[model samples]
Target chain A: MTGPVLTVRDRGGQRVATLSLGGLARRAGIVGAALVVDLAVLSSAPGTPWWPGIVVLTLALVAAEVPDSQAPLLTLAVAAGWWLAAVPWPAPSPGRVLLVALALLVLHATTAVAAIGPPGRVAEARVVRAAAGRAALVGTGTTGIGALALAADGRVVVPGAVGVALLAVAGLAWAATRPTRQ
Target chain B: MSGWHPTHAHLRAVVAGFGLLVAGLVLGRVDAIVLATPLLLVALAGAQSRPSVVPVLEGPQGALAVHEGEDVVWSATISGLPAGGSVAALHPGQRWLEVEPETGQVVAADDGLATTSIGLRPTRWGWRTLGAPAVTGYDAWAAWRWVADRPQPLRLTVLPSTEQPDTTAPAPHPYGLVGQERAVRLGEGTELAKVRPFEPGDRLRRIHWPTSARTGTLHVTATHADEDAHVVLLLDAVNDVGSSGGLVGERSSMDLAVRAAAVLAEHFLRRGDRVGLRVFGDWRVSFLPSSSGRHQLRRLLNVLSVVEPGTARGEDALAARQGLGAGTLAILLSPLVEPASTQQVAMLTSAGIEVIVVDTLPAELVTGDRGRSPEEQLAWRLRMLQRRLERDRMASLGIPVVTWTGPHSIDKVLRDLARRSATPRLVRR
Candidate 1:
């Protein structure tokens, strides 16, 4: 009656900056695995022994360091830039790997949080389900293209051609069918 | 309102997305563009999403106003929508004019839900103010946190049954308002309308004998005028109904006070008298100077419904509680639990407002566990105490106290108060 009752307001989630060290290690491992059967580059340049592995390792670490959403874009730019700028050497095969998968993954990830309902609450199951569904369908299409290119070239293409195809497909699809309803 | 809780779908999505991000870097997943694009897009979109809330008001019963004792069909409506949203009206008081959830159309019946558009039914003859409609929208389907709403404060006054009209009380001061009006105007009445029925006491000179005899019945055509008996009904919401409260709704003392106010207001209105109300609790009682007919009844009932109780000191209430115009009778209803309130009533009567206190107290409650041994003694002592206090208080003021003790007691109390009113003024003090 005398003064207004003071009730404390609730603060939501806490913000965390950047990636943790564990995340970096995980990225490094993924990149190393991708290079396991990839002997095309190594086979062409006989003199370069551990250098190719080292480069892949470095790329993987850097890519992992990039946040999930930005990771794909940055990886595309960095990987393409690195391969183009590098000194010319006889390479066994182009790296068509990881491109389509990465592109689809980015597309899928964006749709994950793109919801149309009330604000502040967590993303709804329907949105998540739709996003996940789309991601699966997209991931299959994108990665399948790269795999096809890989088989055809007998080596993973550098600056992944599969990624280019996936990007074109996703972009076309997105532009063609922008949802009319919110 | 209905809301969703965090489910496995959410966790799974997070897992798959994060797994790819980590896998992309470690395995150098598809070209860098493939994995990185989706992650970045998702993150950006998620970040861009804003959270908001919609407010809604719901009520019991259909959108139309309802009276007490009637069946209630309550419903709720939501407002302040979130995107791609869904709402479920929960609880028994959910009355929707229509129920079409797929199209996102759910109407609620109630009032005061500010965030939501209000839908209500006047369930009783008092103001029906509803709490905010329960509505919580989420950014996505996930109901991360629910926001409790402040009531969309609404007021729907339910006027009591036809007001009886308080034509009985005489209004001397506050010029324009005097006594209850009739068709044939009286020299002492307020307004002059018409003359129809003739009584035995008709002045011989004033009679229209030819018209009366021709009509076969002794008749005097009367006129209609604006007149009223100014009576103030003071409500005491701080009452106790009984151990279990009252009627299935657990109405409590406050309910009695409200109903009493409604009935009294109706009575005063019907008699074509000016009536006002004075509520005691959370909000100050209302005052409408004496007026006549059905309109005044509507106004009084409306005020009764919205009259909130306040914490004004007993004495402060005492001053404003009785809106008197010299001869206005103050019909007060209180439980008289506290001495402060009773003292104030005594003071009002002393100041000349004809005070009549209706003790709307709760019935005494004691289960089998409560010993019956001292019942007689306790009753005797309580009665003695009440009498002593009441007698002492009335001795100094021209007022009477009526106790609504049990079933079938209202009529008796009304008669008692009426008789007391007829007593000589000096003798009353």
Candidate 2:
């Protein structure tokens, strides 16, 4: 008998992803739902153009069918679409902005869940619930930040200080999540 | 265990958050930053809350041995998970080791340890490898996962269920040793043999008082000696006919043969008879010398477990007959598909080895079409008829053939052989 040895590698600090045909179908459903939310967020925003929403929806739908390795690109594209649509608007309300952001987060989270584990395996209830809980907390924080910015009338401008602070925070986030070589 | 690492989801969140934050600040669009804060904060929280210690997986343990149709629970535990706890999934290697609900999921405990139980059922008798279960541990947010390093492989040995045969038979021949079977020689034993006039060397305890009183002379009671028998189980593993649906479905010829051999071995061994096993087939031929005790029974079953059907040449029959011991009752378990086995039975019987053949061929093989064409069915029928003739030929040589039907399968044949053993017979040199 040999001593215990771990054979699986911890690359990307992610669960070994499985892409079963059933999981792919489930992911497609999730993407479709996210698109409907995107459309709703875009249609509800004042003076927001419909073309960006259509483009985001189309890209997300197509991305849903792509292999998991390339599927993340679609998530980025969809987020970009929402950002572009909101950018041209004359200062949309914080509530509408927060809604669109939450929707995008949901899309990304669902894709992540769907992409992980072996194919044909459904995500465990606890895993899904825990992820949802995390996403919700993030959504709440985003809402709170949006509320603060709205309260200040989007005019709390401290250019140099904010940039330095943002860079520091981003650096910390990157360091925290980065895989530590054993 | 490897240290924590950010998953693709975490990275994606970080990128989306940072891009929006930088873009919003540069373009002077407060809405973009507002949209980005949530993603950023979530990533930050996940990153900051990286589990302090990697979870160690404990086991895939419990009930390593089980009966057929019984369930064995294989479990593993993960400890040292963060507050959000972890989710562990089990992937048992064998397809027959069916997992309950078919979803291998278990949530971690509040103490940061999670145990997952998977149910496994063995369908057949043998040593089976239940390959190592791959355990993947996901953190609270499912953002990062720590997989257990190499898990140990597990093996399960399934022992055949020993069904006791109801009917009993006298041993054809007994070795002159103390045991359960009564021998022809008179000695001090429980079974009364005779009452005779006491000789001067007779002990006082041997005197039969009533006989002494009636005859006015001392008489001694004599009893038959108890001795053991040598039982040789000759298993013909040359060919298997019909499909085996494991323990539940229709038994193949090999299944029947093995199970019957096991039952016979257990029965004789329990009665203090020295039992041996000899398997002849296309594969490896295994032979065990006659021995008595629980250990020998275990050894016999282990040998029988690995028996598989092999291509039988005429030489195998002669080799099998040669393996039998003198004055031993040789029980041949076979489907009798090959003519070689029939010839072996005839040779053993003619050599005065007291052979009995238990027919293990499933009746369906001869009757059921089983999707065979008319011409194929006709050929099968013809082959079965020839097999019948061969069986009859063995009977003519004084080898009784019986079909295995659980208990009482060999009782009548054994009884007949015992009766015939009383008469003197010539042993071929």
Candidate 3:
């Protein structure tokens, strides 16, 4: 968004005037992830109005450029909301859910990478690769979750109880990960 | 840095995951629950991988002393980062320092340690302080972040870049006993002066056989003494006119003055001449006494590197008090923009010290650029006229002025001075 510049400001407000090939590549990666997210949402809902997807894509662009801002979170929320509203609710397939989930995961991971440093930072290849590996792990887990949900669609004795148990597990994980203050 | 704090990305993941899960349960939508699964897993993994120990950051690494236009690396390393944790460093830009990657930002994963570096090339000489590198650590998932304490900025003394001027011109007034220049005084030396009648205390080997036989008397050969010249470089640092664009770009008045002084000092020192330096308009009134050898050259350059213009403008009397020897060749390097500098030249000439003025004002500044307004242009024209008048005055006083044009620039002027020195003339006391 700032265009390909020889210099840019870092998070510490210092003017980083060194141009880097690795930095440019990282910026491209961020934009690419956002584009993929937009495409996946659009493909998931065939007949839905494209305006909502376009709006999410715009937010995604903002997020890619300014990862430290609230734009990235807002973009994710808008994207997920669009997918839910556009896709047919009860008849949504496992493969479609997995596809959208994978796309969102990529977008989130890339935005996180960009957020680690200043807008002009050249994110290390190893760091990016590690993020991808983490995303893949999450993607695989999501697919398994979806498969289990499909298998238990009518076979489970108490579906509500099963949902409650899943929620409790999610809550526990969140509590365990919360940062402890000094 | 304090203990790791949750980043916005982590919060985004948690909120999205929890929101989607609650929505799925409320609407009985299996697709929504499935979508929430990935977000939840990412958030949980991020939490698990959160760095516990504060990363230890060290450096900006590299040499603290270098010459102008020399390339050096400025870098910082962060250690103790957890596996998969990353570090981001930003080294800001500063004037006269050219950094590679224009944007001095770098991110590296902790593979035992991460070192962020930028190639630094100084454009000009002086004491320079490089911007301190700011490092921040992030967990593999970028879920947690911590910033290292800012360290002291790197300071370096950039020695003035010396230009090797190809000048074999001998100094007009060589005085001391040991040197390459032929002195006017009669002494024990190799070159023949004349075969005259032998005098008392004359060595037996000095007798000229053919001349002795022809004159019917013992005759002796006399030769000019080989002695060294004392060169005192006087720098005019009253005002540094024009903007310096570093080594490759347009040079400022001070840049030219300092560099020219450096070249002259090196030349004289290499020739076994005692070279000295006096910085006029410096508050400290820095003066290096004339001495010979390569060590003296280093000391002279070190002194030149610290010259700051307009530092002692009020101390005109102190700046003028340069204690030069009788036969010392004082090379005054100045832009000649100020009246005080011209006065100093007149004072040295009056003291019977041989002085040569090297005009160090850049040509572009002398030839007015079109960017200036009419009034500015007029003022500059008037200034030039005044400068020309001063130069004419110095010239009439038998002092030669030459513009610095790199190698052999002052050779012609020095040759003329040497010829003039041979002839007798009235010199002011």
Candidate 4:
């Protein structure tokens, strides 16, 4: 038997780096979604500084490495909040809101798909494509909700008590449906 | 019980969506609600589609035994996952086993059942125990995950690869009544010996009409008897010199010895000859009695697979074994690095058995510096000189030693032995 150093050296000599094709595609999806969201932020808040966008992009890259972490979701929320607070006035047009909502939808879906396995895992192509389809479905429904909210804003108002009760009920339902940990 | 559990994606969606919705309601910002809408829907979809039944994970599916260098696909079957769910299977890395995807991770999705597989190619021969594969199930949106319990670990037996030794030389001593070799004594056979006077029990076809006409008396042809030979392979496992680089890479002395022994055993057994094996230097000096057939070949290969280099203490025990029969051709495979291995050669040759010594040392080790210090280099050179002197001594003692070079390495030695088998020699017993 030889020493561990030589064994490790020989093994290193024999190893060849392998890149999973599926992993590359998933990473691309993450970067693409981040770029779309960043573009929407830029269009929504034209006066905002550029550094925040760069920081969000860096976080997105980190999320690409570890999609299971909170970096992706945190970056998405930061981007959406910056746009909401940076822009002055009654708000950006409905078209801008539609674009931002669609990008956020893609970011969430892609990050979720990437989290299904480890960084090196090669996910099936059909599954990723199916996830994209599901994201598009959610995007369509979200666009409809945005249109409805915009149309009914000045015409309707709910009592403060009813809104609080609805929030409490939704919170209770969500807490009850939380998965039990083994 | 449901094995499904919420994943981090689900938690992130809920926290982010709910936080955004509450903030939008408090500030009356329509954009926050728009932003939270998709995440809320995704979280709701994942919660609604949570798997109700646990997936059934089965044992590995693949060949449990394979020859070295052959590719094997090890897979696990999982059922009862929800539609559009995905499963990821992972088999941890093992020594001498090359796993495709390198990480041993594979992910696939199907209706309710799926099989995930990883490719394994063993680089060396011996028993390899594979760690139990890890399987995880993910729902359609990956909001929920169910990790199945690990299945039983796979135990694979990698048999030594047979390096075909291109030696058609007949065994020096044919001992049995039925085989490919022509025996010394006259008997019912095909090869002509001579025309002789008619003997009692001579068949009518044995009559030589030309000889009978010339001699004016009945004469019959005689032929050599067809018989089989007994071949005993004596393996030297006292020391495994040099470094092994697996099947396709550099080979050490022990690797050469085992592969050569397996090759010779298969060659002899395939020709309908009785072949046996005696592994020296093992704890008990493993021995397999002479036998013929496919089963014997398998048994011999199995024995060769598990041979570990042993100390000198087992030599005496090896000497005491009684199965080395007379007229048996014993082929001793060793690097002759240790005195004990050379002593084995002396013992076999002294027993009046036909013996051939195959040098199993790698050629490069004979001259390479091997990154040794100056003092160690000198010692290595001296050892090589001693090995050379030992080889010369064995040759002078009427024992033939040949270097192993894969196929055809022993053809000349066997031919020489066959030619000399007729000469009478002294036997101690």
Q: Which prediction has the highest TM-score against the true structure?
A: 4
Clashing pairs in 3: A16-B103, A17-B102, A17-B103, A18-B101, A18-B102, A18-B103, A19-B101, A19-B102, A19-B103
Ranking of all predicted structures according to DockQ, beginning with the best and ending with the worst: 3, 4, 2, 1
Enumerate clash totals for all models, in the order shown.
119, 7, 9, 0
What C-alpha lDDT values do all the predictions have?
0.44, 0.70, 0.78, 0.78
- Ten-residue segment with the worst summed lDDT in candidate 3 chain B? B101-110
Show model 3 residue runs off by greater than 4 Å.
A1-49, A91-93, A147-182, B60-63, B105-111, B186-224, B314-321, B370-372
TM-score of 2: 0.80
* Alpha-carbon runs more than 4 Å astray in model 4: A1-17, A46-49, A150-182, B61-63, B104-109, B310-314, B317-322, B427-429
**C-alpha positional error of residue A164 in candidate 2 after TM-score superposition, expressed in Å:** 5.0
Candidate 1 on A1-182: residue-level lDDT in tens?
01122222233212223232322333434454335422433443445454645665455445444323334333333333333223132223434235423433532243223222221222224444554554555466555654554454426445664464456445533432343221
Off by over 4 Å in 2: A1-39, A42-97, A106-133, A150-170, A173-182, B22-31, B52-73, B77-83, B99-103, B109-112, B193-221, B311-314, B370-378, B396-398, B423-429
What is the TM-score of each candidate's chain B when compared with the real chain B?
0.51, 0.87, 0.88, 0.93
Worst 10 residues of 4 chain B by lDDT: B312-321
Flag the better candidate by DockQ, 2 or 4.
4
CAPRI grade, predicted model 3: acceptable
Which CAPRI category fits model 2?
acceptable
RMSD of 2: 6.9
lDDT of 4 at B117: 81
